[model samples]
Structure formats: structure tokens, C-alpha cells
Target: MADPIKDTRRMIAEMQPRLHPGKYVFCSGIRDDLAADVANVAKGSFVEDEGMSFIIPQEETDRLGIAGGVAMRQITLMVRSALDGVGLTAAVSSALATHGIPANIVAAARHDHVFVPADRAEEALAILLARQAEAQVGS
Candidate 1:
């Protein structure tokens, strides 16, 4: 694997944001046999006092009998960013927010995943690409 990027500009310049297909939703209170099949495939999940919160595919909601509200799309940052990388998230989120797009960032070991509303996904991806280009030019 490549060394994780730390420079804010470099990280943004190379974070090739790829918008994934399909819609997803955030739900909670799922902790039963019905959830077994979808558990491993969840884009993100966490355990809270109320229940198990999950960012799952919208299609899975039907079989799980959960309300899949607010369809979203996942955009994976292709740049390998260090866990402590500064400014990358802020820069990306700010760019999207400026255009009235809400972003939920999930930072993992390899890269950062962004979830944005499905309807606005194309616009969000375009914004991120523009940000990347701007960073590249600045570099």
C-alpha cells in the first residue's frame, strides 16, 4: 500500500472522488437475525445507547422492515489519507456545504467515504472534482 498522505493540498489534489451506485439510508434499532445478512455490507454502523445505528443500502430496508428515509449516495475518496490528516475533511466538507450540500464523512484506514443525498450526489461529486482540480493547481 502507498504511504498515507498528510499534506492537506496533496490529499485533496489526489482524492479522486468516485460516486458509488445505489441509494443508502441511516437507520437504527436493528439487532436481530434479520440484520445478519446486511451487517457486513453496511457502509457504516455504530452502537448507541438507543440501538445499533447503521448506514445501510435503501434496498435492504424492505427485507429488514425498517424505514429507509432520505436516500443517499456514497462517494469514496481515492486518496489514502492518514488518520490524523488535517484540513482535508474541512476543505471537502466546506466546499460541498457552500453549495448547500450536506455531507457525512466516514474516515476509515484506507480512505474517507462521503455520504450525500442521492438527488444531490452528482452535484456533490462535481463540486469535489472541482476542489481536487483547485488543489492540484495550487500544488
Candidate 2:
């Protein structure tokens, strides 16, 4: 019998330390109402204040916000190797898809993070944790 959770964890173990678990919320960078409401908001590499309108884990937020709805999830990502190509992303995406978990992956030079709907964060964590476990066992 194939244990999906075990397999997923195996994949995660082989990657770099990428997941930083926390409540990631969207906030305004420049204190602009339009930017706050829009789907596109600036991601702060460093949070000036934890009380900011939308404060996630200081590490999870990026320096620049792209054109996508940010979904907060508890499961952290383990990015394998420098994100020089899209292979890792495609693999992660496919894995998530198979689990019926929808995800939007953003890959940076140093690491990669996944944004899933806030409502689905727990479920997403279970999936990611499984992946992490799988990676550990394999290694």
C-alpha cells in the first residue's frame, strides 16, 4: 500500500528549509487604501510592525508583492536547490493537485513558498507535513 503522506514528506525532506509557519495576512506597505484593498499589495521583506494591518510571519512575506491573492497556510516549504528552473514548482504543484489541494507557488532565487486559501490552511498543512515526513524517511 502506498502511503501518500509518507511520500509527500520524503519530497519535502530533500529540499531546503523554506516553510515558515505563521498567520500571514496582507497589509499595506505605503498606507494606501487602494493598495490595501486590491488583490495586489506589497510584501515586506521585513515587517516594521507585527501589528500592521496584515502581518504574517516576518520571514514569510516577500520584499515585493505580485499580482496574486496571498493565501496563508501553516505548512512551510522546503525548496530544493536554487530556484533556477521550474521543475520543483511543477512537482509541488502536481503533488498538491493530486491531493485536491489548490495552490499558487511563487519561486524566488533563495527559496519557494506556496500560497493556499486561508480557509484551507490546515488541510494544506496536513499535505505538506506528509511531504516533509516522506522526505525524512527517504533520506
Candidate 3:
């Protein structure tokens, strides 16, 4: 495995945002049998207390009867960011906020994933790319 990046600036500059294929929905109450069902159909991030707020494909959501409405698309930041890294999420979210994009971020062991409105996925990606470009030029 490669070393995780700790520099906030480098992380942002090199985070090649890649759009995940498929429309996804946010689901909750994925415990017990429901949890098992979700596991079989889709993979997603789980947060305790907040319940499982992970992205499940729309088709899987519909077939599994998971209650989700707002359609979203996943944009994975292809930067191996350290979990302890600072300012990465802040910078990304700030840029998106400036563009009036709502971002639901999930930081995994290796990468950060942002879920944005399905219709604005392209726009969100452009915003992220621009942020990265600015970081590169500023460095």
C-alpha cells in the first residue's frame, strides 16, 4: 500500500475527483436483517447513531424497499488522505458551498467520497477540479 498523504495542500491538489457510475440514495435503519440485506445488494458507509448513511444504488434502494428520495451521485477523491489530515474536507466543502452545491462527505481509509445532487454531479466535479487546479498553480 502507498503512504497516506498528510499535507492538506498536496491532498487537495492531487485529489483527482472521479465520478462513480450510477445514481445512489441515502438510506437508514440498516440493522439486523435489513443490514444483511443491504450488504448483499450494495456497499456503503455506515455511521453509528446516524444510522447507515451510505449510498446505495437507486435500483437496489427501490428493490430493497429502503426509504430514500433525493437522488445523488458519488465523486471519489482519488487521494490517499490520512484520516487525521486537516483542512481537506473543509477546503473541498467550502469550494462546493461557494458553488451552492450540497456535499455529503465520507472519508474512508484511503479516499474521501462526496455525494452531490445527481443533476449537479458534473457541476460539482468541475468545481472540485477547479479547486485542485488552483491549488496546483498556487503551490
TM per candidate comes to 0.93, 0.50, 0.89
Worst 10 residues of 1 by lDDT: 29-38
Candidate 3, residue 7: lDDT: 93
Better of 1 and 3 by TM-score: 1
Per-residue lDDT of model 3, residues 47-117, tens digit only: 76756666678898778777877999999999999999898899999999998999999888889999899
> Model 2, range 1-139, lDDT digits (tens) per residue?
3222223343356544344555465444433544443334333333356534433442334443422235565334554444344355566667678878777665554456776667776666666666656657767
Better of 1 and 2 by TM-score: 1
Model 2 C-alpha RMSD vs. true structure (Å) is: 10.2
Q: For each candidate, what is the lDDT?
A: 0.91, 0.52, 0.87
Q: Please name the candidate that would achieve the greatest lDDT relative to the true structure.
A: 1
| Candidates sorted on TM-score, descending | 1, 3, 2
The true-structure Cα RMSD of candidate 3 reads: 1.8
